[model samples]
Target: MPTVDPTVLERPVKLHHLTFLDEGEEMTVGRPDIDAYVHLPRDGAELLKRLADGDTPEQAAAWYAEAYGETVDMSDFLETLEELEFLADDDTEVTTAEPVRWQRLGAALFSRWGLAAVTLIVVAAGIVLTQRPDLIPHYSHAFYTPSLIVVMLTLFLGQFPFLFLHEGAHALAGRKLGLKSRLRVSRRFYFIVFETSMDGLVSVPRGKRYVPILAGVISDLTATALLIIVAASTGGLIAGVSMALALGTAMRILWQCYFFLRTDLYYLTVTVLGCKNLHATSRDLLLRRLRRLFGRPVGEPISATETDRRAARWYSWLLLLGYAVMIFSLGYVVVPSLVFVVGEVVDRIIEQAPLPLLLDSVVVAVLIVGQFVVAGLLGLRERRLNRTVSSQPKAGSR
Candidate 1:
């Protein structure tokens, strides 16, 4: 491995292509090539810009001392940049190729004409729903089949496509702006969900990020609207399937309202509030308060921007409310449903029901149990990974 020179700061530094954005009182400076960003005070950002403009560390530090009435530790700043992989060995400019697979499709979807078409569809769907209130989504729509197994199977399997479309919309929106994104399975509490990771968005201007952040919810609404229209226009099984899809899509749309779970809307909220990590900061604040109440060590104070600290003061309450909501949902919805299903299964077995009936009940039980098993396994895996990573030595650690 090439070792960094001890007196490197005395000479000019080479930097990768960096993007800067003024975010409220802070500035977001990032190396898009590595998708690494940091929120810095205006002075820090200016110092970095000066360094990137070929000023030696001594020159930048002198300027900082004169302008900010304090000196900057160039060694510490260089270490931070090294951690972010922002330092380049050569002066050659580097250009990364745009991700091409979905670029064109993404562009087309967000185009002016495409947006107009979507507006028309949404408006037409709204008119249809208003005229035919019967077509609106209901929980009952999920039970499109008489067989418990069939209903479970339809709902469980049928939702994947719509879920893909929802997450795909988010990915495409980011892709439209030449941002690379990855879709992965992640857990939000007990729910296993698909998420689009678009780290590059932090480097993008705030005004342009809303569409990418909201694309999933918009897709869900659009899917629900289209499904409602299809349900209204069709009959029999087709109508039933459409209604089931509409119900599923509608539920997903509503799921965004649980911002405490760090849902899409939570990202929107943080972005709008100009917070770097509100959810995490709020969680830490809540934990500290609880620890104090229990007479336990409260540990160190959370390090966060003033905006985040201010928002966390109230957001912490919302975080507690979120826990309460989860508990209430488990009690009112999950527990009751589990009891009812188990009771039915027990009764069916005792009565020596037909083979198909017995099999349906068994399959439904397995599906429900399997989902919980998968969630538990994923949680365990995540915890193990966290432990492993924490045990490893950090970069430049002695």
Candidate 2:
């Protein structure tokens, strides 16, 4: 622990947003400004509150000792606080303006009525799908008229616009809460995903945070519902394309279940549990288990932080289950689909005329090869990140 001057009082730190959460058996300190938080003991929380309210480290420590019959380690506590960025220095400047340009548009679209209307559409779509089971989209429906390759290409191209809207839904939801957001393209394994960064949502209440977290899913699901409805109501090429859109959007909605990727639902769980670092804690737990299974050295599985341990005890199982599901999917769905696509592409190329074959093969090859190249790039990036993180010291370590 670094030495502290007993005579010089540490300055009180001001945070963008501060909230105390009670978890029946524990207390958590939430700092939304920096999208960070820490779990503390009852006494520790009280001491922090005092410090935040302008009490000097010495004064807070003295008060804590009087109440708990033991002296608090001010040096270690302050260091930990600083490491977490809970203690803001003079150099820290808070940005007050909403940075995103589409703030007003977003808020209006995700408002209470907007959500209510979406809910109504989903319910209506469910009714239609149940009543007319024939309307439920199948892969065969997409390939019924056009050649499978052409239909696949068309559907793939169509999703580009919807993908933007999906991410925009998240940004809009954040805007409704006076938070700004940005859209970025990110990769999850080999899959390219459009994402919205709404870290500012942390500043909002936990209950309100659900809106932005779930907004993209809501958008995708809604699109699925609308497209399915259109497909059922119409016939011919329109119906086929609508069915394709419906299936594509529906799959995207289910894709969120990949919680191992820190998907939307993962963030929601983190907020609800008041967990500061569930992902890292759960990942560490998995590593410890793997080490033990493989006869390698295993350290503590639980986190050094009490709150993290509490969240991890339960959440770690979900992470394990997610991994299991992913492996199952790779075998059951992904591998077979890849094999089928490659076979179809080869067959089409062989069956077509010279000029047509060259054009069609190039298109199919680009789609398949592009996915593999992206996967390779992401794998390398993950390796680099793993190495960097491994070099850094773990939190709460002396």
Off by over 4 Å in 1: 1-5, 89-100, 335-353, 393-398
- The per-prediction tally of clashing pairs is 0, 0
| Candidate that would win on lDDT | 1
**Per-residue CA lDDT of candidate 1, range 91-143, in tens?**
56654434546888888998787778888889999999899988888889888
Q: Which predicted model would earn the best TM-score?
A: 1
Give me candidate 1's TM-score against the actual structure. Answer: 0.91
> lDDT per model, in order?
0.85, 0.75
Which regions in candidate 2 have their CA more than 4 angstroms from the true location?
Answer: 3-33, 91-107, 180-182, 198-205, 266-281, 304-325, 328-353, 385-398
- Judged by whole-model lDDT over C-alpha atoms, candidate 1 comes out at 0.85
- As a whole number from 0 to 100, the lDDT of residue 292 in candidate 2 is 90
Given candidate 2, what's the lDDT at residue 259?
A: 74
